[model samples]
Target: MTTALDTTDRRARQVRQALWIGFALQLAVALVPLIDLVTFDSITEHVRAAYPDWSADDVALDRNAITWSLVGIGALGCVGWLIALALAKRPTASRITVTALFALGLVTSLTLLSMGGEGYDLVVPLAHGLFTLLPLLAGLTAVVAVWQRRR
Candidate 1:
């Protein structure tokens, strides 16, 4: 009997696929945080009316953090994202970068919420952040292990 392919190679190929998928997920979220800038002020006004305890400073700080995060992490992480797909032999580095980027995304999201954003409750945004985080952590570790073994 003959196998269709090398199991190890097939696994590496799977790892490659996962790496790309994780990259894709993060890519998709590139716009999630931006919604704040366009709608935050209006939302915060309503929130303030509904909940008097909410502060104006919270809105600006949250808005600024999330917006900055969208720009910085979303933009800067592109290189790492490309590397995850394009690197022939540096999947480890790619994965590490991907992990870091996802982590950054999560932190950014948390920062946006914790800093106090009356614009919106963090439940939805935090949910999205978790979705992005899972793949990044899992795929990055897999990619790194595979690359390390490959070498």
Candidate 2:
């Protein structure tokens, strides 16, 4: 039969597994921005199509800014995931940290997504925007797993 200690251990193991999965998801999403940075010509085309009136230099500047911003944000998210993983043994701390990070990530993604006129346009390519939002899935999973009740 299962005792309280057994349940606690099982939950901790579940939380650890979820944290690892979240880290993997965060890493994968982070790489998407790096890929975008490497193949930036596609980003330039998208930016030019979105803003036809912009000059070549303007397009280049905008593409660079968007790509770099995504890369930076992705890196930050990966770091946050690592921190959450480290705190997994401390259930309260881990849950709070993961939940806070998830909220911050969600806000940042929404803000990035609403970067154009009327606050409803994607500043980056649709794929980039979607990729940026992908880490939230990881964050959500981690948050849920960490906060699961002792049942």
What lDDT would each prediction earn against the true structure? 0.54, 0.77
| Residue range 1-151, candidate 2, lDDT tens digits | 8887888788778777776776677677667766766766677777878888889998889888877887787778788888887888898898889899889989988877766742226676777777677767767777777788876
The number of the candidate with the highest TM-score is 2
Best by lDDT: 2
Clashing pairs in 1: none
| CA RMSD of all predictions | 5.7, 2.3
Q: Mind sharing the TM-score for model 1?
A: 0.52
What's the C-alpha lDDT at position 140 in model 1?
54
Superposition-based RMSD of candidate 2 using all C-alpha atoms, in angstroms: 2.3
Residue 29 of model 2 has an lDDT of 69
lDDT tens readout by residue for model 1, 117-146: 444555234444454454455455544545
